[model samples]
Target: MRFLAGLFALLAAFFPGAAPAQVVDGAVPGRAAAASVTDPENILVLDLSTGGRVRIWLRPDVAPKMVERVKTLARQRFYDGLAFHRVIDGFMAQGGDPKGDGTGGSPLPDLPAEFNYLPHVRGAVSAARAEAENSANSQFFIVFQPRFALDKKYTVFGRVIDGMQYVDAIERGEPPASPSRILRAYVLADNPPPYVAQPSLPLPAPASTLLPLPTGPAAATPKSAPSPKPVRRAARKATRR
Candidate 1:
C-alpha cells in the first residue's frame, strides 16, 4: 500500500492541477483536469412546495451525459411536483421518482453510471439507481452529510451551492409522513426568477378577526384632510363683544 501511495503521489506531482487521491477503501485515482461548470448559469433550481429552494451547480466535467440528462429533464419540467420519496436524515434526500415510490423514472432510457472521482461530500447530488450498475435514470439524491462510502459508487453530477440550509431541513423519513415536493424546477441559465421561500402569512388571522374589504371607490380613494368648518366665525353673536 505504501508503494502504491508513493506511486500515486509521484503521478500527481507530474500532473498539474490533479486532485489528490483520497484514501478510501484504497487509493483511487484523483480528479483530472477536466472542464467543469464554473458559472451560475449551469445551475438547477428546485422550488419546493415546503417553500424552500435548493440551487445545485451541475458538474459537466465529471458526468457529462448525466448532467445533460438532468438539463433535458429540467427543461421538460420532468421533475416538477416530484416528491422526496426516500429521505434518510444525515444521509440523503432521494427524489425524482415520477411514481413517488422510488420505483419509477422518465420514459427515457436509463443512464450508464458516470462514476467519477468526485467525493460524496455534503450537498453532493448523485444519481440513484437500481441494483444494476447502469440503471440510473431520472431519480437522484442529495447528500446532507459527507458519505465517502458512496464515492465513485454513484454518479456525482452536481453539488448544492446555495440554499443548502433548506436541503438540510428536508423532512426526515423513508417516505415522510407528508413528503415535500419540487413545486417547480428550471435551469438557472434560462434566467428564471430567483426563488425566495418566505413563510406563509399566518392564514390571514381568521376571517372573523380580519378587517373586511373596503367597498368600491372607498377602497381606491386616498384619505385627505377634512375641510375647515369655514372658520366657524364664532357666531358674530355676542353682540360685537
Candidate 2:
C-alpha cells in the first residue's frame, strides 16, 4: 500500500527510448531489475546499504548544478553504505554519512551551496547544511511537506520518484538506537557510455603490486574500497511521462 505521485512518471520520462509499460499504479519493478536499468532518465538508482533500492529523478531544468554534483559523487561511490544519522519523526529522515555520524561526509571536499527557488515539498531533495550557505558535501534529506521557509535558502534539487514507503519505513531518531545501516549505495549510469573506457586510474604494476613473492613477511594488505561495477549506459527510451 504505497502512495505514488507524478514524480514516478518523471522517472519514466528522464530515462528515454522505452516501450509502453503496463504499469499499474506506480509500483516499480523489483530492486534487482531496477538495478539493471536501461533507461536514461534515471538519475540516481540507489542500492541502499540496507538492501533496499531507490530511484531518483533528476530535473536538469530545475537543479542542474546539484544533479552534476550528485552524479560525480555517485560515480565515486561517495555515499556508499553510510548511515542515515539523523531523523525527526513527522519531519524527515537524513543519511549519507561516511562515519555513521551527523558530521561525517565524503572523502571529497564540500560542495558550494546551490540554492534554487524550488519549494521544499513532499519527496523534495535538498542539501543539508550547517550554519553556512555553501557547506554541503554528501548530505541531503527528502521533505515530507512543503517547507516554504526553505525555498531560497536550501538547494531543492530532486524528488523521490518511487519507493518512498521504503524511505518512510526507516527507523527514526537523531541517531537510531541501533545502527541504521545503508547496506550499499551505488548509482548506475542512466545512460551508460556505449563503450567501456579503460579504467582511468592505472592499475599497479604486476610484480610490485601483485601477490607477494612469499619471500618476506606477508605483504601489507591494501584497503578494499567497494566500487560501482559499470553497466551499459542506458539510452533515453521513449517514456510514458
Candidate 3:
C-alpha cells in the first residue's frame, strides 16, 4: 500500500482543498452550514459567465470597510459584465476593473487598507491594490489555492463557501483571451434576480490611459505588465524551502 499512499499524498498536495465534501446543485451541503453564512446581508453572490453562482461570506468583523465597499458597489450593479481580467492558474482570479485591463476602479473613492489576520486560504476573497496599500478600490481577487504569505499584505474580506467548483472553471491567463466575467453581482439581502446565462459579447479593447489614484490615498505607481516572478516565488515557498 506504499504506492497508493504516495499517490494520495501527491493528489493532496496539488488539490489541498479537494477533500470530498457533499455539494448539491453547486451549493455546499448542509453539513457545512454551521460554518456557512445565513445572514443575507453578509453574503455576496456572483453569477459568473463560467456558469452558475458563487456565494461568499463577507467578514465584516475583520474587514468592515472593505465589506462595505464591496456591498456598495454590488448594489450599484457596478460589477456586472466585468472581466476576470487577471487569472493565474493555481493562484487566483482577479477582476472588477471596469477597464478590463487591470487598471481601473469605480468612481467611488479608494479605500484605506483593511489588512487583517485572515489567512489567504483557498477561496479567500481579497481586494487588489497598486503598490500603495490604501489604494484598493473596486478591484478584487479570489484565491484558487492557499497563499498564507499574502495574509496580512492584502485586505481579505470574504471567503467562498459555495460554487467554488465554478470558480475553478475560470479561464486561466493574465487576461484570458476569452475571459470569464461577472454576469451579475448581488447582496443576498436585496433579493436579486435569479441567475440567467448571458449571451457571449465581444469585450471592447482596453484603454491605454490609467487613472491616477483617488485623491485621499497616497499616489499609486502605475501598474506595469504582470510578471511571473511573484508567482514563482510564492510557489517555491509553498513547495520548497
Candidate 4:
C-alpha cells in the first residue's frame, strides 16, 4: 500500500483532476459527473455530420495548456467539417486535420507536450502528436477502450461525459474508407457560434471505374456471323454432278 500512497501523491501533485479517491470498503467513489453537476461550462458539445451529438468535459486542472488549445481552436470553428481521418475500431477516433487527410492542422504553431497522469479510460480525450514529444497541434483522439499504456504519455485533457455511442459509431479505419466528420464543434462556455454542416469532400473514384456495361437486348444479341461469301455457283454445280 506504500506504492499506492506514493502514486496517489504524485498524481495529486500533477493531475489534480484525476486524483484517485480513497477506496472505502472495496468500493470506488462516484464519477466526476456527479461532482461536475454544477459546472456545466466545462462541458463541450460536438455535433457530427451524421447528426450525432457528443458531450465532453474538459479537465484544465490536469492539462491546462491542452484544454486551452482545444478551446481556442473550437471557438474559432477550426474543427468544423474535419474528418475523423484515423479511426481504429475498438480503440479510438482521431480528427482535427484541416486536410481531411491526417496531415493538416491550423496555421497556429504546435503546442508543447502537456503529458499528464490522467488515465486513458474509455471516452478519454487526448492530443494526437507525431513522433516528436512536442509536435501536438490541432489533432486529438477519443478512446473507445481502456488504454492504460497511454497513461502519462498523451495529453489527456477531457473525457466524454455524454454521447459515447456517437464516438463508438464513428467510422473506423486508419483512414476510414468513408470517414465521418465533425459537422461543428464548440465550447459550451464560449458562446460558440451556431453550427453549420460543411460540405463533404468529393468521394474517391469507384472501385471499378470501367465504363458502364451496355444494357438492353440489342447489346446482348451477338451479331450473326457475316454470311459466307456465296461459293462460286459453277464450283457448287460441279461438285453436285
- Which candidate gets the maximum TM-score versus the true structure? 3
Candidate 3 lDDT score at position 68: 91
Per-prediction TM-score: 0.68, 0.58, 0.71, 0.66
Per-residue C-alpha lDDT of model 4 across residues 1-241, encoded as one tens digit per residue? 9999899899899999997577775445662322252365677789876556788988876677777787888888888767776675656677777665545557787778888767878999988765456767787888877766666666888899887887888877656788788888887766655655555554222111010111342121111222323422211111110
Candidate 2 wrongly placed segments (more than 4 Å): 1-42, 49-51, 190-241
Give every collision pair in model 4. Answer: none
Superior candidate under TM-score, 3 versus 4: 3
lDDT of 2 at 225: 19
lDDT of candidate model 3 versus the reference: 0.74
Per-residue alpha-carbon lDDT of model 3 for 1-241, expressed as tens digits?
9998788788878998765665775555543222237889999999999889999999887788888989999999999898887776777788887777665778887788888878878899988876556777888889887776666778888999999998999988756788898999999999988889997555544422221211222222332335645533222111110
Give the alpha carbon lDDT tens digit for every residue of 16-66 in model 1: 568454666433356444433456557988887676777898888778888
- Model 1 global lDDT (CA atoms, 0 to 1): 0.66
What's the candidate order when arranged by decreasing lDDT? Answer: 3, 1, 4, 2
* Candidate 3: stretches off by over 4 Å: 1-36, 206-241
Give me the overall lDDT of model 2.
Answer: 0.51
Q: Candidate 2 on 1-241: residue-level lDDT in tens?
A: 1334465666668865443455554433431122212344445766543335666776555556566667777777676555566555555566665545444455566666677656767788777654456666667776655555566766776777766766776666545654344444444454433222121111111100110011222222221213322210100000000
Pairs with backbone N, CA or C atoms under 3 Å apart (clashes), candidate 1: none
Quote the RMSD, in angstroms, for model 2: 19.9
